[model samples]
Target chain A: MSSLGMADKVAIALVLLALAGQLFFQSARRRAPYSKLRKVNAYQSADLLISAVAEKGRRLVLGIGNNLTDQGASLSGVAGLPLLKAISRRSLFNDQKLQTVSGDGVLACLSQMVTHGAYQNAVAVELFQPGEAVLAGTTRFASLAGLLPEVNHRANGGVILSGQFEGETLLALDLAARKNILVAGSTASLGGQAAFLAGVCNLALGEDYYAPAASLETDPAAAASLRAQDLLRIIIAIALLVGAGLTIAGVL
Target chain B: MKKGLPIAVAILSGLFVLAGLIFQPYLGPYLGLVLNWAVIVGSMALLVAIASLIIYHARSILTARKGFIFSIVILASFGLSLVGGLWLGVDNPAYLKWVGAIQRPLEVSLLGLVALIMTSAAVQVFRNRGWSPLTVSFGLSAIFFLLIALGLLQTLEVPQIATVIGYIRQLPLVGARGLLIGVAIGAVMMAIRVLLGSERPYSD
Candidate 1:
């Protein structure tokens, strides 16, 4: 739309460099004897659920929350796509395939693509079923009424509600609890966080939403992104503390 | 090109939006056009989603699934909404009223469930986790939550109570702000990955 300004250019350059640095780490780690690792239960649980659900003869359900949009929760959903692909790929031979329920139209589209890609990897392009990803509803809560029944009945007992979710998360999580299904979800909103804390499921709070994606990749570069996020978080916390202190001292 | 084309479009769209936000002079004029195109594409996706949903439920009904009636209801709702939105025009008061009639109740009911879910979860947490930091916080918040929600603690009646509530309110705000910052960083990382073609969701 417009030319990038100096600050805009700088920010873009910094982000690109940071991402590139992560890639460099990914490549370099291949040669290194060892690399630091972090445990994210969300990804581990996804893997666990694959086996658990398969053994139980139940399908693994992926609830890509309806929060996905061009502006809102798009990145969060996009970040989780790799894992969706991973899970879909991993669950190829299972009796029940991965069932994706999404509330947003755009996300439903991407999820279909992800499912198809996974199939293309696992078997053949012809076997890619577009129905793998179902559109539940347009809004978060509206989607819940349509989604919960599907998960409760078809999924057998596994659900992952990772995406840009708002208040409606509580219902899905509650339904999961009633069905005694394993549920783990991440929330980006304050209300959603509260609901999540109170809902019956494994929690992915705040930015931990990206943990599944990077952890699932296990690429040193992808993992480096987590470290970069941690660095940024620390800086922000420090800035907040400084701001609070300065405000207390009546300084602008 | 399966992966390359989508990633390229994403990078271009992302940069255009970023430039529009930061520069606002040169790129701002085309921002609306780009956004409009996004809306059109998104609408197309929604249309496809509708078709998929219908086909899905139709299959269920054909199979005589236990809850096949629910499929009929879902289809009817879709038809009604389509007719309302398309025939009446989205801006028409009839459409607006119809939306509010349906959405308001759903929103309220869903929000109402939040309270019950929170209470049940808090109780379960205490029983299972046995009073961890989270449970303890929930317990403490429960006391003030009732006092504030029930309007027992009048802000004007007691200046100290008002100050306390105000301070407590700021806690969640601060946490939310921090979380937003975290989410932003994560988003940036994802954008960078897409731009670099390191992470392509479109291709195997």
Candidate 2:
């Protein structure tokens, strides 16, 4: 019954291992529909956006969703790098231009991944121009405003907003929709409010932002991490149920 | 060494931060000073971004691009704002008045313009994808609407409805918390990967 007992530590470690294993197997199989219940909303959105870009021959616009360096967690920014890589590869394969914009330095690191991804996909480095890959904006609204015109004029086939979006995402999505561009979005924070007003986009909530790379690349490490997350969720749920039952029985 | 330097710096800085957190009385002052340096670096980065914007836009204008006029306007506004803020002081009455006069109206108008755009976009979404796509969209949408409704009703003094809605909203917080805890564990593993040089963000 001790709070910091060996049993609890061992149990938690086992749960994490189990989760990692699940993710590894699922990613390796590549048969897991982006989610257990349904397709992961973000992956579905990315797929839809990619298809639209491929079909329309229009450029894809990706917003890293963090306008302030201080506002987002470092982990969210890191997670976004892989997603940017995957999206950039898809853009290159389709011979579509991928325009990325960042609001902070941490978010800007994603440009490296986009560049590498484009190169790995055998897209000419010249064609994958630096200016075309990453643009930085000063303020949140200013970045949204700057990207709005680009979305409107570029005839963007698809728009992907993932990372740490705020009120600006709704504005960008609204502009994209007006241009008849397909848009998909996800935010690591609760700012998914913007996704609601924007309407009918593939949006990921909280940790679901991590689902795309595993789904797309089937990378073993990423798969294992995702599996760990799933198992952790189950363990937490069981713990919650037990706590509730004990409380109800007045045993605590 | 090039790749290792960043990871090494990250570890040292991370340790400093942790020490500050755990041993605040002894290390707090130094951490505070370090954080100030972080802010200075952040400011430098912002300056770089602004400079890039100026260069990009100037080139576009010089080349007589289609959006040259707008670029000019942006540049002018940016320059004037910076000069005014610096010379007159942002807290000065004149500068405050200028901001008060311009900012709210500009923001309101921008919001209004985007509202119209949102309406058109929503109509287009319906026209292109129909109700099925609408129904299957992100769960965040439902949460957003619920929160907005709850906020509005609470302001209107509807306590009973607001209370119920608030509790329902809190239901997702539990799941969100669980997800966060899971993510924290994943982050630790990923950090270990980076520290062990298994995952390199800088390398191709």
iRMSD of prediction 2:
4.9
True contacts kept of each: 0.58, 0.16
> Could you estimate the TM-score for every candidate?
0.88, 0.75
Cα lDDT tens digits, model 1, B89-136, are 989997999889988997897788777876777777677557688789
Candidate whose TM-score is highest: 1
DockQ of each: 0.56, 0.23
TM-score on 0 to 1 scale for chain A of candidate 2: 0.79
- Candidate 1 docks at the CAPRI level of medium
- lDDT per residue, candidate 1, A1-252, as tens digits? 245567676567667656665566556566641246556776677667777888888877887777666445366766556667777777777788788888888778888887877777766778667768888888767788877787778547698777766666777778778878887666555666676777766667666777675666644446666766666667667867998999999995
Interface RMSD for each candidate model? 2.5, 4.9
What lDDT tens digits, residue by residue, belong to model 2 across residues A103-194? 66545544644565567557466565545644556556666677777777665677777666665467777666567777777665654544
Candidate 2 docking class:
incorrect
